[model samples]
Target: MICSHVTVPVMIHLKLHELPAKHVLKRWTRDARDIIPPEYLRYQKDHGPLKYSSR
Candidate 1:
Protein backbone atom coordinates (compact mmCIF):
# COMPACT_ATOMS: atom_id res chain seq x y z
CA MET A 1 0.00 0.00 0.00
CA ILE A 2 1.18 3.52 -0.84
CA CYS A 3 0.22 6.72 0.97
CA SER A 4 0.18 10.24 -0.53
CA HIS A 5 -0.09 13.66 1.13
CA VAL A 6 -3.07 15.76 0.13
CA THR A 7 -3.29 19.55 0.45
CA VAL A 8 -6.56 21.41 0.43
CA PRO A 9 -7.18 25.08 -0.26
CA VAL A 10 -9.66 26.92 1.87
CA MET A 11 -12.17 29.37 0.40
CA ILE A 12 -13.69 32.11 2.50
CA HIS A 13 -16.54 34.47 1.65
CA LEU A 14 -16.89 37.68 3.59
CA LYS A 15 -19.53 40.35 3.01
CA LEU A 16 -18.45 43.35 5.08
CA HIS A 17 -21.55 45.32 4.20
CA GLU A 18 -23.70 42.62 5.73
CA LEU A 19 -21.99 42.81 9.11
CA PRO A 20 -23.76 44.61 11.99
CA ALA A 21 -22.41 47.55 14.00
CA LYS A 22 -22.34 45.58 17.26
CA HIS A 23 -20.05 42.94 15.74
CA VAL A 24 -17.54 45.67 14.75
CA LEU A 25 -17.68 47.17 18.25
CA LYS A 26 -17.21 43.73 19.83
CA ARG A 27 -14.15 43.01 17.71
CA TRP A 28 -12.66 46.50 18.32
CA THR A 29 -12.97 46.21 22.11
CA ARG A 30 -11.47 42.68 22.09
CA ASP A 31 -8.45 43.93 20.12
CA ALA A 32 -7.92 47.05 22.29
CA ARG A 33 -7.19 45.16 25.57
CA ASP A 34 -3.74 43.86 24.48
CA ILE A 35 -2.29 47.15 23.18
CA ILE A 36 -0.48 47.98 26.47
CA PRO A 37 0.43 46.50 29.83
CA PRO A 38 -2.37 46.45 32.41
CA GLU A 39 -0.17 47.93 35.15
CA TYR A 40 0.78 50.93 33.01
CA LEU A 41 -2.86 51.47 32.22
CA ARG A 42 -3.70 51.22 35.93
CA TYR A 43 -1.13 53.93 36.75
CA GLN A 44 -2.63 56.22 34.12
CA LYS A 45 -6.13 55.47 35.30
CA ASP A 46 -5.28 56.24 38.94
CA HIS A 47 -2.84 59.13 38.43
CA GLY A 48 -4.47 60.84 35.44
CA PRO A 49 -1.77 60.46 32.75
CA LEU A 50 1.97 60.14 32.21
CA LYS A 51 4.16 63.23 31.87
CA TYR A 52 7.01 63.02 29.39
CA SER A 53 10.10 65.25 29.71
CA SER A 54 11.85 66.17 26.46
CA ARG A 55 15.62 66.59 26.37
Candidate 2:
Protein backbone atom coordinates (compact mmCIF):
# COMPACT_ATOMS: atom_id res chain seq x y z
CA MET A 1 0.00 0.00 0.00
CA ILE A 2 1.15 3.53 -0.80
CA CYS A 3 0.04 6.91 0.53
CA SER A 4 -0.09 9.93 -1.74
CA HIS A 5 -0.96 13.59 -1.26
CA VAL A 6 -2.86 15.55 -3.90
CA THR A 7 -2.81 19.29 -4.38
CA VAL A 8 -5.64 21.34 -5.85
CA PRO A 9 -5.63 24.92 -7.09
CA VAL A 10 -8.41 27.13 -5.82
CA MET A 11 -9.71 29.99 -7.91
CA ILE A 12 -10.86 33.24 -6.34
CA HIS A 13 -13.23 35.64 -8.06
CA LEU A 14 -13.71 39.31 -7.20
CA LYS A 15 -15.80 42.07 -8.81
CA LEU A 16 -13.82 45.25 -8.18
CA HIS A 17 -16.54 47.37 -9.76
CA GLU A 18 -18.87 46.50 -6.88
CA LEU A 19 -16.32 46.94 -4.11
CA PRO A 20 -15.68 50.23 -2.31
CA ALA A 21 -12.25 51.72 -1.69
CA LYS A 22 -12.59 51.38 2.09
CA HIS A 23 -13.36 47.68 1.71
CA VAL A 24 -10.27 47.20 -0.42
CA LEU A 25 -8.12 49.07 2.06
CA LYS A 26 -9.39 46.94 4.93
CA ARG A 27 -8.51 43.76 3.09
CA TRP A 28 -5.07 45.09 2.20
CA THR A 29 -4.36 46.01 5.82
CA ARG A 30 -5.36 42.57 7.03
CA ASP A 31 -3.16 40.79 4.51
CA ALA A 32 -0.24 43.08 5.18
CA ARG A 33 -0.44 42.65 8.94
CA ASP A 34 0.11 38.92 8.50
CA ILE A 35 3.42 39.50 6.67
CA ILE A 36 4.72 42.66 8.34
CA PRO A 37 6.22 42.94 11.82
CA PRO A 38 5.02 45.38 14.48
CA GLU A 39 8.18 47.52 14.35
CA TYR A 40 7.71 48.00 10.59
CA LEU A 41 4.04 48.93 10.81
CA ARG A 42 4.81 52.64 11.21
CA TYR A 43 7.01 52.72 8.13
CA GLN A 44 4.42 50.76 6.16
CA LYS A 45 1.67 53.12 7.23
CA ASP A 46 3.58 56.14 5.98
CA HIS A 47 4.39 54.53 2.67
CA GLY A 48 0.71 53.95 1.88
CA PRO A 49 0.01 57.68 1.66
CA LEU A 50 3.36 58.70 0.21
CA LYS A 51 3.18 56.08 -2.54
CA TYR A 52 1.40 58.51 -4.85
CA SER A 53 3.56 61.50 -3.99
CA SER A 54 6.65 62.06 -6.08
CA ARG A 55 8.41 63.63 -3.10
Candidate 3:
Protein backbone atom coordinates (compact mmCIF):
# COMPACT_ATOMS: atom_id res chain seq x y z
CA MET A 1 0.00 0.00 0.00
CA ILE A 2 1.25 3.42 -1.00
CA CYS A 3 0.47 6.36 1.26
CA SER A 4 -0.97 9.68 0.32
CA HIS A 5 1.42 12.26 -1.24
CA VAL A 6 3.70 9.34 -2.11
CA THR A 7 5.45 9.70 1.20
CA VAL A 8 5.43 6.02 2.19
CA PRO A 9 6.05 2.77 0.39
CA VAL A 10 4.78 -0.38 2.07
CA MET A 11 5.75 -3.76 0.68
CA ILE A 12 4.34 -6.95 2.09
CA HIS A 13 6.64 -9.89 1.58
CA LEU A 14 5.06 -12.85 3.23
CA LYS A 15 6.70 -16.21 3.74
CA LEU A 16 4.72 -19.42 4.01
CA HIS A 17 5.57 -19.76 7.67
CA GLU A 18 4.05 -16.33 8.46
CA LEU A 19 0.65 -17.08 7.00
CA PRO A 20 -1.32 -16.87 10.24
CA ALA A 21 -3.82 -13.98 10.17
CA LYS A 22 -2.96 -12.63 13.61
CA HIS A 23 0.75 -12.67 12.84
CA VAL A 24 0.20 -10.79 9.62
CA LEU A 25 -1.74 -8.08 11.42
CA LYS A 26 0.90 -7.81 14.09
CA ARG A 27 3.72 -7.49 11.58
CA TRP A 28 1.91 -4.87 9.57
CA THR A 29 1.05 -2.81 12.64
CA ARG A 30 4.60 -2.98 13.89
CA ASP A 31 6.27 -1.95 10.65
CA ALA A 32 3.78 0.46 9.17
CA ARG A 33 5.43 3.65 10.38
CA ASP A 34 8.92 2.57 9.40
CA ILE A 35 7.90 2.50 5.75
CA ILE A 36 7.21 6.24 5.70
CA PRO A 37 10.00 8.56 4.58
CA PRO A 38 11.21 11.06 7.17
CA GLU A 39 10.52 14.01 4.94
CA TYR A 40 6.82 13.34 5.10
CA LEU A 41 6.75 14.24 8.77
CA ARG A 42 8.26 17.62 7.95
CA TYR A 43 5.73 18.19 5.21
CA GLN A 44 2.89 17.33 7.56
CA LYS A 45 4.18 19.83 10.11
CA ASP A 46 4.65 22.59 7.55
CA HIS A 47 1.09 22.42 6.21
CA GLY A 48 1.90 25.28 3.91
CA PRO A 49 0.57 26.28 0.54
CA LEU A 50 1.23 22.91 -1.00
CA LYS A 51 -1.76 20.63 -0.98
CA TYR A 52 -1.57 16.84 -0.90
CA SER A 53 -4.15 14.26 -1.79
CA SER A 54 -6.02 12.90 1.24
CA ARG A 55 -5.95 9.32 0.18
User: What lDDT does the true structure give each of the candidates?
Assistant: 0.44, 0.44, 0.46
Regions of model 3 farther than 4 Å from truth: 1-30, 43-55
lDDT of 3 by residue, 1-55 (tens): 3343432222233324333464355436745555657666554443465657898
Q: Which 10 successive residues of model 1 have the least lDDT summed?
A: 2-11
List, residue by residue over 3-55, the lDDT tens digit for candidate 2. 12311111113323343444345436556566776666667654554334567
Runs off by more than 4 Å, candidate 1: 1-43
The Cα error of candidate 3 at residue 13, in Å, is: 28
Candidate 3, backbone clash total: 0
lDDT of 1 by residue, 1-55 (tens): 1111311111113323333454345335646555756656755444566666898
Candidate 2 weakest lDDT stretch, 10 residues? 2-11
Using all chains and alpha carbons, the TM-scores for the candidates as numbered come to: 0.20, 0.21, 0.20
How far is 38's C-alpha from truth in model 2 (Å)?
Answer: 0.4
Worst 10 residues of 3 by lDDT: 6-15
Candidate 2 regions off by >4 Å? 1-33, 46-55
Q: Give the lDDT ranking, best first.
A: 3, 2, 1
